[model samples]
Target: MKRLWGILCIMVCCTGELSAQKAAGFKGWFINNVKIANSMRTLDLSEQPAQLQLTFPRYQAHSYLVNMGIAVILNNNTTLNYISDLNVEYHRNTLTDAEQNNFSAGYGFKWRFANAGAADYFMAGDLQYLYNELNATNSLGGTFLLTLFRDGKRLNWNTNNFRLNNRLLFNLAPFAGFQMQEILKSRQNGMAGFILRPEFSINTSLAFCKKAGPPYDKLLAIFCNYTGRDDAINTTSFKEHYTQLLHTGINYYLAYSPFEVSIGASFNDGSDPLNGRTQQQYWQVSVNFLK
Candidate 1:
């Protein structure tokens, strides 16, 4: 009787293990990737006699990024992932122009819950730090995002996940938070202006070749930003304005791998009195690794 009971217990344990594996599916892993890229641009927006476009001739910039993260499949119904990256960028223009350098660090977390049928709800958060040489300043900022969607379902003529996703890809995210600095140093006193910056972006990504082995993703996006100082400096008057930044791009991914590449261009029109009516254009290429 004792031996019979032991055999039954073993059978029960084996069954439980099989059930757990079936429920979890193929998920949960950690991966890391490194990225490097070069960019060129021209920015001209200043106020002078005859409205001179103070051309800051084409300059080369290099970036190095290190990303590391882990994702976990909590159950058949939920998933969680986290990532952190460190970025360093350097740029050089004319010899007379001062070289600029920026260092940033970012962290993000995402949580997803699967609903009945083809639908899911997700929440995410991101934080970043910026260090620059132009003003020898440091800035810290963060954003929070929330989303609800039903995959490939049309709710209205122009309302649905498809339209929303496309809008996000080429424009500002629907929900977001932002904060930053205004002035690094005061002209007379060594005072600084701590500013609050808020922004919104919307973009859309349209995928083609669904019937083919892989799909192609393209995006168009637009962003608007505003910033104001917390306290006005005595020597200099503080002003606030808005800027419109536009971008269009294409991205491609290889089969069965986290390797993907993208190419894009950005255009910016200044909306600030200090920046005058400046217009700037830039080109970019990037690689993403996930595993």
Candidate 2:
């Protein structure tokens, strides 16, 4: 199970970041990839809109997670968006005197279809690449045995040494949702007058990796035998495994003109679309600084 856990770590990475060059040439509106159901607002005019998240994962001593995005308006009813997702992490295992570093970056675009009343729809996709390595030593400063998967290309069996694996992955997601604006309005004199926006959406994502072969096929077989179920795996030998993710959530937006905040809970049910074994659901709070 320890070895399985290590393999799982390489498969479950997610997040994005913008390069300094990209930031300098950025133009358009900032919007969350999954939260675009209303008409474009003046807030979308901001040059750069970014999202930051901090997470605490076991054995990871330090980590940074950032998701930054920008959108360009193509017309009254259509918009184009570019987003970057990055995650950088460091892990330390005191029990084995081992350490590892992992990094991944993904950039993608989304097209917002025409909006009709309170309902909205969009089609978006992104490609992500990850590279990581591991090193370990024993009490006598001797090498410890470790094996790692290198982007499905080859396996590395070594000690006190690390190898690189740059895994290439892609995901296509479509979002459909509705928003009821002004569900609540506060009439406070001389104040920005609080307003509430309640929204709901169904999100689905299809993710796949480029490399297809052994272990990949064998891994899918293991999941099948373990789950004792069919249909979830989705692909066979030649195609390896393509994961499907289903995410549903309801969020309430509190806005005071120019500034908005949201709090919501979501239920995310799916396999680790990257062929990893990890799944989670939770609630979150977000403040839109540029809105």
Candidate 3:
């Protein structure tokens, strides 16, 4: 399973810096993901690749923001990770309250620092422009947050970065991050939401790479995130309070190359306002390619 452990490195790749470190120039990466829903019963199944996303980092870095980065994304419009309905009542991003889209482009900035003798830290902000053909909704939004770790790794814009501090060796790498987002504009409506997540993993550094490195090299990573969204918040309509979503995932990365695979599951905590008793759960699998 050494190969499998390498593939699972995608778990600690949350920042993309790890994956980009593996790239040659200008740090770039492409990822494809698919999700499935059990639909409250094992027999009733629905699945979709859901989406693909890529990140490109500029060659300049500053303390306020690391190198500026760009992103392109395509959504397949086939996911229920956001609601309790099988078909969906109101569409929204599974990670945030913003409306969902079929395609999108975005820009972002990052501030990175490290304490070789202690821990690692990261904070970033992102802005996106999105469009959906099916709903004809146009949107804009972004988020800012901080992450904590215990490694001596830094960002490398000229090359893909996979190197991790080998000083600290811990079996289970525990880390957490918090973020807040602004739903600038969603179609013609305004929305609000928040997400909270904490993740943990086993150090799976490629057996061939250094025996010790940051947690990203770990072969297995697991996490659960909570998403709370409300489109009608502070509005006149008292339709419902808000929607709640819980997402759990696992990923594998092969340190030998720039490739990774992942699987995820989600649970909707409320009843679909439209279909009453139709509670839903989702599953997903993803593969990523880095150059």
Best by TM-score: 1
TM-score of each: 0.45, 0.29, 0.38
Ranking by TM-score: 1, 3, 2
- Please, what are the lDDT tens digits per residue for candidate 2 over residues 107-146? 3333444454443344333333333323111110001111
Q: What's the C-alpha lDDT at position 193 in model 3?
A: 28
lDDT per residue (tens digit) for residues 129-215 in model 1: 444544555555444445444544554111223344242322222333343444444333343455554544343333333332223
Can you tell me which runs of candidate 2 are displaced by over 4 Å? 1-103, 110-125, 132-242, 256-259, 275-277, 281-291
What is candidate 3's lDDT per residue for 1-291, written digit by digit as tens? Answer: 232223223222333543354455433324322112221111011111133322235232211101011222223366522111111111222232221323333444444554344544555444544444333445443444444444334532212234344422222222223222332333333332222222221212121133543343445444443443343323322244454445455545444243333343333342222111122454444452222
In Å, residue 259's CA in model 2 sits off its true spot by: 5.0
Clashes in model 2: which pairs? 15-85, 15-86, 16-85, 16-86, 17-86, 258-291
Local distance difference test, each candidate: 0.33, 0.26, 0.31
How many clashing pairs per prediction, in order?
Answer: 22, 6, 24
TM-score for candidate 3, please give it.
Answer: 0.38
Model 2 weakest lDDT span, ten residues long:
217-226
lDDT ranking, high to low: 1, 3, 2
Q: Report residue 234 deviation for candidate 3 (angstroms).
A: 4.2
- Relative to the unseen true structure, what is the Cα RMSD of model 3? 16.8
lDDT score for candidate 1 against the true structure: 0.33
TM-score of 1: 0.45
